[model samples]
Target: MSQLTGPVPDTVFPRLGWVDDLVVPALREAVGALPAAEARVAGYHRGWTEADGAPVESTPRRGKAVRPALTLLSALAVGGSARDALPGAVAVELVHDFTLLHDDVIDGDALRRHRPAAWSVFGTSAAVLAGDALLVAAMRAVSDVPCRSAAAVAELVGALMELVEGQSADVAFEEAPAVSVPQYLGMAGGKTGSLMGCACALGGVLAGADGERVGGLREFGRRLGVAFQCADDVLGIWGRSRRSGKPVGSDLAARKKSLPVVAALAGEGAAARELRALYASPHPLAEQEVVVARELVERAGGREAAEEEARRQLAEALRALSYARPSADVYRQLQEIAWAMVRRDA
Candidate 1:
């Protein structure tokens, strides 16, 4: 087993290679049961196949598969075998992909994972249908888990609802005159945190963990997810294109009300005033305006504030890990994972 005591993995399989052997094949098994068209879209979105469903030359899978890995790790943290949590892992990964598919459609983002998004290649309707199919498949996978797995199914459903609500709020925020930091955090918690919490909780439920510890794992994942989002918000405007797979200021170009933007607009300074005026226009930011917006965000201290929030949430996540009462090694492993979530360079 590869050690799980570092930052997030860059490759499809982390140095923690255990997930490669277990999670990938099981995810394939779950997705393999879908109809041909949905499967093709799913496969392509997952980087498992070309847009036509033909196999791609072997390369690192586009995503880090972090949610699935967290599910399996939660199983281990709860003193259960990773194999026993395969269904949960598969369900989490499917749900994540489902969200990404719809998110691209909603955001009108043409790229994903450094390539054309599924909706960009396939029709938007087809991508939406594929996302719907994945949702069904995810629920089916959860239900297949042995004994008392009903809880897992319910939790996944709850997360999906929460995710939808967050996404809805996000859409609304774009047109709203002002959005508070608290509102942004709440949206981030739901949009990103809910499923992450569900990933850990489902693992615990499937592994037969008790309610208290399972709940603890849920909170831990929830906090970590917020941290992850904070990092992502920072990256959205400032991250390197080669590492992030998206051009710098992509979020700015879209006029997204991301955390940093909201935080910056909260400022009382000249830069913040200028930024608010720039963002008030209904149209997307022009290319040069994106550059100006980046500068305004930094000048208004949004970047530092967002980065600090990420650190704060990371600490909170570690503190919450106490409730899970994992073994020393497991505790340390989770600590590493929490750090990675907030500290990712991409």
Candidate 2:
């Protein structure tokens, strides 16, 4: 087993060599099954290939791979081998990539993982098409898993439907006058939680764990997913570009109604009015305006409210973990990862 103490490791599966050493290879192979141009775009988006199709000089951090880690770890928690869950892990990762590719296009994000987004380098059509290809590829990745592969695919597709609904709601929110806290949380749960829950549940399903245990794992992942999003919202407004690999206050610049921003708008008095007006402005925010927006979010108690909610969700996640009945070592590792995710600055 890998060390779980000290600072957070470089990868979500720092202890599980197979996640990086084995699953990644299989994922790449699965991605390679796409058409040549689509495969090139996918590889480049995954930090494996240059724009021109040459291999990258060194490995780059594609993403946290938290969903895949949860899938493999949940399998181990239920007394199954990590290898047994590799197909599920790969499927979840592909689904995640598909969402990101389309989200980048929708949000007009120029940067991802400290490089140009696929939509920015390639055309929007290529990015969207590649995303569609990934969804199809993800289904193929899990189609041949023994025993419960068909059921797993059904679960993933259901989660994808939920994700689509959440994204649609998010887009609609841009034009709405107000969004309640519950509504925002519900959207976050759908957009971020559904797939995470499915990832954990797949482990238990594949391991033949009891329904109660699978449900517990699913709930644990759901709560953790909310906590992750809350922390991410915090980072979006105030985190350093160097650490987050995006411009400071990028959400503000885009006029995005993130958790903290929404909470701030709901506050009383002059600050809220100022924030509302700033958001309503037609032009992109200037750098100074972005700084002001960040300050306004902090001063209006939005940051505090969002942080407190994250802590609450984290506590709830730990409560769910108790019912999960994970092994002693696995429990420790899960706790560490949970804290790292909920408490992270970037």
Candidate 3:
């Protein structure tokens, strides 16, 4: 459980660079090759143009496409042709975008990838419809996988259900009087971890890996997902406003029951008391109070605890990769990517 205490390192997967080049083209083609029904649905869902003369590109600007890369790479790692996994790649990317579109609307977020969010540019109704369209498109894309693998499609659907359930819990927790560490973990596992697991599982499935190997990759993805969320929690608190493209302590101000706050509430003595007071108070937290609240959570060992949990999850992910018995090179590359994920500055 080594701590990634400094700057993130370069990717271990050299092939990942090559995959990056292929991904955008593959995604574009996958979308383009869809049946007219699916294509129209996706275009409408993305809000590419309005009925009026005005045009707005609701398509989210290009993202890193990390999830799809993982799916394609996992397929290659397990001895399958990356080309065979293209539909899975397209399906997962569409699902991710769908979630983002809905999430932006739910969170009332204005910015995404440095541009106005879909909900901000189009109305919330349009954004919601777009998200729905993307989701349907994902299913359509997966259905086109040449082998007609029912298991892979079922796994993807299960992951989507888990995602929705997890999101439900997240919204519920915000309204709860208090949230425990376990509850927070459960929400994160559902909302974030499941999709990553699906990516890896889909890869293994496409490669025709044995059950044990597929299970191992699934666990690896799940652990990495948890670590990813913990890292996000860390950023939500201590990240610089300019660097994160949001105001610092924004989570605290929203009174969201994130992990750090949960840990402080569950810890020993005065720091815990002060946090409770802050949570209980109706008055807006002043700038200095926000700083003090962060320090209090750290002093209460909440920050350390969260970091430890992240490390634990990362170690578990590495161990799962061992079970997959990947090539030493591939394993090391995955480990490097995992480390970079936790250590990323943005």
The numbered model that scores best in TM-score is 1
- For candidate 2, lDDT tens digit of each residue in 64-107? 67788888888888888888888888888899889989989997
Ranking by lDDT: 1, 2, 3
**Candidate 2 stretches greater than 4 Å from native:** 1-13, 61-63, 242-244
lDDT of 1 by residue, 198-228 (tens): 8988878888999998998899888888888
Instruction: Tell how far residue 219 is off in model 1, in angstroms.
Output: 0.6
Error of 2 at 332 (Å): 1.4
Task: List runs of model 1 lying over 4 Å from the truth.
Answer: 1-13, 61-63, 242-244
Measured by lDDT, the strongest candidate is 1
Arrange candidates by TM-score, descending.
Answer: 1, 2, 3
Query: What is the C-alpha local distance difference test score of candidate 2?
Result: 0.81
Clash statistics: count for each candidate: 0, 0, 0
- Higher-TM-score candidate of 1 and 2: 1
Q: Which segments of model 3 are wrong by more than 4 Å?
A: 1-5, 9-15, 30-63, 241-247, 282-286
